[model samples]
Target: MPLGILEDNKLEHVPGTAPLNELGRLDLEIGQAIDRNILKHDSTGQIVLVPQPSDSPNDPYNWSRWKKELFTVVIAYGCGCVGAVGPLLTPAFVPLAEQFGVPLQRFTLGCNGSCIVAIAASSIFCNTLAVKIGKRPIYLATTLGLAVSCFWAAEVHSFGSLAGARTLQGFCMAPFEALIPASIADIWFVHERGFRAAIFNLGVLGGINLAGPIAGSVIQYGSYRIAMHGMGGAFVLMLLMVIFLMPESAYHRKGALNIDTGDKVIVTDKLSEASIEKSGVQEVKTSTTSIPSTEPPKSWTQELLPWSGYFDHVSFWRTLLRPFVVIASPVVMWATLLFTTCISWLVLISITLSQIFAAPPYNFSVSSVGATNVSSFVASLIGTLAAGPIIDGVVKMMSKRNRGIFEPEFRLPVMITYIVFTATGFFAWGESLYEQQPWPVPVIVCMGLINLGIQLGTSSVVTYVCDSHREQSAECFAIMNFIKNMFAFGLTFYVNDWILEQGVRNCFFVIGGITIGCALLTIPMYIWGKRARSFVFRYKLLDRVLKAP
Candidate 1:
């Protein structure tokens, strides 16, 4: 008997149940039919069993390009809001210091302290939460939590209150950073992944750049509280957009509910009709029976602690340790550290440049200095648009040359071009400071280059980490973010002091040298990366010992 037919007959015989409503029944029957006939394969038959194609309409990838773009945009914007708010709040330090009766230098610690906590908590919790409640819910909850934190921050009267709010906000916002990448992975195929990631990256950078000008305008007109309130409103709007527009991307098996009977119907048939038809088999109807779903629904506790049983899982520990392991691989470690250094340099430059341009011979007002971020905005947009397509193109070209086999290292060539451009910009900025060149020329040109370097370096390193450690990409990224932000937060505090002591020219010279040094490390890394990988693979002791028995 044909398995599909038999199962359908059994479904029909279930006592006290009416036929399913049109949509529900159609979906069920279609799914069942596809599973039985197309997905199932027979080994005994002369006929070859071809697997079912996932090109069906129900597949998320089969959705219209516009829908995919919309999804990308929403995820990008949500992550952007979460990422930008913390950094933007840095510029309001003066106001915060005055209001809270704290020293400006001491108050800066609040930003650093919050970032430290965020890094620690996110490394521990983001992946677990995403696995627990699913990405959609975590995303929604994080956005709501950030909004509440912002509101509390605005109303707080004490330094302790504001610091607590910022700390909690950091923790709340971590999930957005963690889950968006996973969501992108789930929704997009490999070919389109780079482009989507670029879009997400651009949104994050753009938000950071835009925050300066937005906050500047708000602070110009109103108090720090008002700025916080305004940001809170934006968060609320984002929350609404997410709830209504973002569909759950995680695969969920909803139990079939009988509309007429209000009881669950378990469909257990797993055979296809085409096999039976080809084998000249007869159709037999089996009696309908009720059975529970094959996989039981997870309990509330399980939902809360998705890593419970997995706590003792060796692979989980390995994943947690994988980033550190990769760090021991010289190429991976150097590339990641250089990437972290580049991020820290650019962030420090951005924060310090605002203070520099707004204060001295330039005498640009707070608003105008804030407006200087336009250079970063433009540079980020161009760099992001160009990086992915160019990297993909380079990979394709190299693969064709190598007889169609892809090597992960093909992505390294463009970094050379980026390094050169970055060095030129750094030299130019230093010379301008030394020569005291025109204000706009130095600020705009330097900012544009610095931003370009940041975009290229960040994108390349992230892609490299993913390629090298495909199974543990999340932990690698989490650790990378933690390190990058910690350095950046620390750098922020001392950058002004450095400029004050060393003079702007010497400061720029020092920073430019560091930038060049970081960029040059990439050349050796690209050359020795393979040897490093080989060494890691050969030495199983490090992997096994650190990962546990």
Candidate 2:
């Protein structure tokens, strides 16, 4: 037998956590053939494109390197900008609180709380619609909606009005949160998705870290309303970028790769009938593939149209159920726990920044408070640049050592880096703030370590889940988006009071302990993850609910 081919192709395992020859494990050894017609990299015949591309020119997988890079960049920028909307007014929160005649706690609840809940609620509908119609139209519509909401926020005269505008912004911002991961899966192959996904995460975290400084600068010399106006203008430019630069990534190829068992590659052709035998489920009825279109490549004008053809095969209601069904999977649940814990710290830091810095010992101006985020932004950038390529390289190295068989657990080791940075960062931040150390202490070194951990942790959880649950990555992310933000929202409900009651030093000491506890979860999952995956599949946990009427 060839080095890469399994002695017995198995159908008894889950999608991406199967044994020797299956979805998660790829035959990366040189000179091994998956199929005669499957596409392989020209530079190295060793690796085949998973979910192989069709011969169609419009398949996102077939796009040129430059084109793909451009699209990724635009998408990252848009996601980042939209994400920044959550905290665009963080530095101005106090001034806005004064103007609206409300306590700062109520103000944060109305603005940030509304936005977080809206993002969670909107994920369900936006994901369903994006899958049904296409993501491009949603992107354009949401960008416009976000711009309008920001402008409305600028003009708001009351607390109710501000909250309403923020709710709308949350709705518009939802797609970028839930759909970007799916978009990456749509375009990039497994090998490339780690880096691509990391870029998008960077955009989101970076925008948030940078928004404070930008808003602070505007608010320092101007007013809260002026800061809103500045944000609104930025989104308008983002809308124009989406209009001209972005293209539809959704494509329905003639063939379908069975990600469940990977026992067979089902390549459909009009001239030949193909059938798929799903593991322990009913076999697909034999059918001839639709004839390939001979249409010429789309011009720029044609690409601008909002509608790409529908993915008629996908059911909106069924897709909607997946977010809930995936909750039953232990892998997904663990990912959510890990992600929410890391993200909560980031959110807490953002929420408490102005309060901590603008008060007594520091007595910093809004601009100075905003400038503190520069350290986190720089740290996140370094993590982004390093984590992605290192992950891909690590996976390849581990796979080769295991006879070209890859397991999603290969990604978990990266979490060790996350654990060290986050735990230590929390202790340092707490101590520095407690002692009323100089701004450079907690703001620079401490925050840098914290954000760096966040970056690494975010990339690891996202890439791991996407790789583990390739077919259900979008739904998995939907659940993650909802749960994590909801967790953040819940924290906001009590976080302020809790900090006041416990004091900063004690609160951070507790937070650091919780963070370490959460990071320690990587151990059990790394050891038993494959078993958990198999358990989910063997029992048909998600399948029962997903296939239910």
Candidate 3:
């Protein structure tokens, strides 16, 4: 019955409140065996962790390392497909318009409009359902549905028909937008999530940039329908992956662990001889859950269709509206604002780049126009490699320096990378384009700096938000995607006008100013982040609203 110092603080339950688990509590604690040993200091030689994991065999925290890694890949691929829809068919806009017998303008917003609305709106229903029912069913159903809708896109002959199909496709793809991050929280510890989240973000960027060339090539060589066919084919494959491998990640952690490791077996008196003597009328039972399965249960059926709560006493309608309530959390709101900056700039890049390359003396072809984005993708990779591993290391170091305490804002200092690269790139891109300098100037500046900045900024905001609110993570992510998409959609719709009004130089100067301001805002947040989190938790208003029926 030995207990450690850090363990004591974590297990102390607040009265009339949930236990201090990933979702219920937000605090630093001693690491489990692996987390403590994941890295070590040379000077003081102490162990550090963001939070410890529970020991329940069913807890995703206890899953084998390989299983977690495999799941991350599958989830990232799914996320990639969903994000690809945002710009997937942009390269084929003209051809699609001709085939649909509509104005190119109508086709321009055809899929993009419905896709944005669906992504923003569907997260409410999709994430809520995933939290209550489980992650597996939603993944399978949505992916298959998305696949079907993708194929439908290949055959559509009218703008109205295309929009209708895209709307459904968006709802199906919505899980990748929000729940994929939640799934990471379900399976990973806080120290492990930043790097893992960066992987998912990379996948998202891949989809956004890669889709342009893919669609353009298909249209250039074959037909626009071929592009949809290929996209649909990927979905079909992912749906199969989901069915065969993606199991339920939501674990029902019912009781508190009483041991130091939180990994020891719970002593059940009911199974003991003395308890059996007192209650001879019944068989032994454990309080871990209402339904218990055999030890190391082995079966493909169970793995594919884990846990049965198909008709659980939950409300889908309430879940649909939960994210709106969760948005009230200050951390969620701020993280979203930071996230929106990246999304707005991303839309600006997508929209304004086409305008620049299509109209200028350069007069780049559509294919070349689309291919230019490859630079951004390359920059994203550099940003990914730079931030992925180091972010976790920085967290471990900072947490250890602070006596093994971890705060959400410890992730904020990385914003310097965003400011330096993004600001320089923004200024260079604007000024170079305004002066109508050589193509190399804007391309090189954007690829090397601004894209790098966007990547880092994206990783910073998402990881911080996900880390700060693990308890309500699914709903919080829904809020992030919902609001961010709305802003992105609107930005794309109106940015041409914004650029026209302010001119390119003035336009990006303002964008650079906003980016710098967002980075500076992190300073106060880092200093007072804990107090702000405490302020939210002390009242527990978000919990009440989210859980309210």
- Backbone clashes in model 1, listed as residue pairs: 36-271, 36-272, 37-272
Assess each prediction's global lDDT (C-alpha) against the native.
0.59, 0.76, 0.68
Better of 1 and 2 by TM-score: 2
Which residue pairs show backbone clashes in model 2?
A: none
Q: For model 2, what is the alpha-carbon lDDT of residue 443?
A: 89
RMSD (CA, angstroms), candidate 2: 4.8
lDDT of 3: 0.68
For model 2, state the Cα shift of residue 231 in Å: 1.4
lDDT of 3 at 22: 31
Better of 2 and 3 by TM-score: 2
Q: Which ten residues in a row have the lowest lDDT in candidate 2?
A: 1-10
lDDT of 1: 0.59
Clash counts for the predictions, in order: 3, 0, 1
Please give each candidate's TM-score. 0.73, 0.89, 0.83
User: Model 1, which residues run further than 4 Å from truth?
Assistant: 1-67, 131-134, 244-326, 329-331, 537-549
Q: Which ranges of candidate 3 are over 4 A from the true structure? A: 1-51, 94-105, 255-298, 306-314, 500-502
The residue-by-residue lDDT of candidate 2 on 1-549, one tens digit each, is 222322223334345632222324444321133332333333465544555565567878888888788889887888779767788888777777887899989988999999998888888878777766878998889889998998999898889999999999998888888888888888887667778878888899898989888888888898777877877888899988887777888776655433323323333344223333335632343232323446567778888887766464556778777789888989898999998888878888888877788888888888888888999989989988988778777776666566655567778888988889988899999999999888898988999999898888888888888877776777788888888888888877877777778778888888899999988988878877766776776678887756555
Q: Which ten residues in a row have the lowest lDDT in candidate 3?
A: 1-10
Error of 3 at 293 (Å): 10
* lDDT minimum window of 10 residues, candidate 1: 1-10
